[model samples]
Target chain A: MPAASAIKVMVVDDQTSMRAMIRRALQDLGFKDIRDKPGAVEALPAVKTDRVHLIISDYNMPDMDGLQFLEAVRADPVIGKTVFIMLTGSADREVVQKAAALGVNNYVVKPFAPAALKEKIERVFGELT
Target chain B: MMRRIPIVQGEHAVVAEPGVIISTLLGSCVAVCLQDPVARVGGMNHFLLGEPTEGLGDRVGQERYGVHAMELLINRMMQQGAARNRLRAHLYGGANIIAGLGAIGSSNAAFARRFMETEGIAVGRCELGGTKARKVEFMPYEGRVRSSVVADAPPPVLNIKPLTPPDDGDVELF
Candidate 1:
């Protein structure tokens, strides 16, 4: 894997506080190049233009959902295969099943910690290298 | 045996030993609790909507919204002699369990955050804002809340048979 400093992470959610909380957690884990937005619609444009290495998104949002965003990322060669981890508050059996079919790098349930995210990110990066 | 207490939105209760905090259904509604450490007394309320109600229903009266529920929870603690300064809160179950807009759960959580800030109470921990239905139990003496929150799939739609059939046709009585 490349040095931790080389990774750029994008946090996507529709809630400001939730995005902030995730950002704080990413910061606590020493990821400096972190960006956040409220939903997939806002993130889609940037993911195409930016040097994003990881995409952590909330599953449900108003304009566009995380799975749709992931589909977009996969369809575009520019951002294809970027490490994607989705977070949701409820990991009911059906939702988890759908996320699995969608090819998420990691699917996390809410009330999670930095360690959980860091470990997932680390694993994603590890597999890439 | 556990007794079921149907907690309506915007209400809370303090249960004696062996009693549980029971709520029927939660869509975009949240339930929060404030527990006094030294006192070991806890209160929980389920709230609906973002603000208090100006309108009233025929039976339930009116509440602007979730704010009323938060206030009710706070008032209960105060009545129990819990110092406002020493109380800590735990939140749960603001869910977009309904379809379409994810906005409602977000609004519910935002209202809760704002209410906690204005009241000057520290929130110790919380599990809020998801697409799920939750049942929570608050152990008042120790101040522990156990939640059985089910997500994925809106609750099973019960097949309610019609009370009266259109007509009683003559069929052979078997």
Candidate 2:
């Protein structure tokens, strides 16, 4: 488990503006340490350093979408156990089913509230405590 | 009255409310809506990608993709007392979505246009193609959509695209 003082988070999404807004939202929620990426391909190595505690990724992306990102994380035992959440504008059944199948902690739709995202993170952390 | 019909990604529904609207948005994906004025019912769908995944939602043997998404929207309208002949269609989105993301959006738009032409559904309104990101608000009752640019995330001209797969392959994290 990562120390509370150093809560490293990595957010991945194809939409750059959305990613920035989400980063600001996390900061507004008092999450001091945050990192953002455009998609899975840009976030992979950044997560391997063993310092990241959570990953917030979008489901649909080029090269590899969200499911591929989850599968990629799963393939590597090192990053397999990290907390995962999916954020997207879509409320598709496939999105829900795939996240369920992959054991994601939460699934959030677009135009979502920062509080809801933070609540899910808190819930995940609370379970660890 | 507007009803909350859960139109799944590839499924669409027709409602009976005058004020309610049927809408869907796409970048690389596409949303197709069809309405029958005489029957006064219609439906819409949000399809991702041009090709159907392997064995995706097949009962016996049905490859549901762009074409399937459109068909489902039409079928749902028929279910809601819409006639087959009076159906009119409209399409929205299919923006480049994001660059370096492949040609999924362009292909999706192409497929949607072809599907409507072949189905004999008179295509009325269509706003598609571009480099901007968009959101589609669909109203089954109104048989129309309001497409808006919610957040424009223009690709970073220099070093914009990410450079990794998952938890490896460079691209500084911190």
Candidate 3:
């Protein structure tokens, strides 16, 4: 696994505040190369060209929510294997089961503290320094 | 007389004495009412989602999540002489007020239920998952709750009469 500084993370959310919040949390975890997109429509193109190592996206949005975005990422041949973590305000069983079926690596609910974010990332990539 | 404290989203309150009512209006949001009858202490919390993370952030911004809210309510109840093993829960809200949108109400209700089950809390009087918004009033000490569908209820009337327009050059009133 790559070091935290080596990982390129992309955050997708419609709300500007939410995107900033996630970015700030990632930076606190030692991630330096982070990019943010307003929604999945814009994020898809950026993800293809930027080669982000991780994708953190919100579950609800005006166009193409997190589940749809995950589907698109999985279907794409180039970045299909990139790690994906969903950010959702709703942690219902059905949504979690669906995301699992779509191959989502993990998900974090809203209002999460910085440590929780670190733990989720660690689960995917092992312990982070 | 009972004192009422209206709690909005991401807020909670605990009471061990009588004459206090915690109330909230809900639409696609869930509120959990917890009580330990033996200790005569309990509280209620309103939340949007279940455990997104294992622990809560230090800031008040973390209060909206179910996991955090639940933990806070339980800890507070215990502080007031409640026991975890004797905790009983009542759930309300999680109504889908509008169509075409996703089932947010269903999701919220499901999360509340799952959280309680995971924590080994026995739930009673669970009123969740419907198309109508609800108004809930809970008396924590007595372990009693009242809920009503307010989706079509009339808005509260204000006592102030309509303001009169002044004969000003620029100012106008409606």
- Among the numbered candidates, top DockQ falls to 3
**TM-score quality measure for candidate 1:** 0.46
- For model 2, what is the error of residue A120's alpha carbon versus the real structure, in angstroms, after optimal superposition? 45
**Residue-level error in angstroms, candidate 2, position B62:** 12
lDDT of each: 0.65, 0.62, 0.76
Using lDDT as the measure, the top candidate is 3
* TM-score-best of 1 and 2: 1
Query: Which ranges of candidate 2 are over 4 A from the true structure?
Result: A1-129, B1-8, B51-64, B154-174
DockQ of each two-chain model? 0.01, 0.02, 0.04
Worst 10 residues of 3 chain B by lDDT: B165-174
- In candidate 3 the C-alpha lDDT for residue B104 amounts to 67
Best by TM-score: 3
Off by over 4 Å in 1: A127-129, B1-174
TM-scores for all predictions: 0.46, 0.44, 0.51
Error of 3 at B103 (Å): 0.5
Q: Rank the candidates by lDDT, best first.
A: 3, 1, 2
Lowest-sum lDDT 10-residue window in model 1 chain A: A88-97
Count steric clashes of candidate 1.
9
Rank the candidate models, highest DockQ first: 3, 2, 1
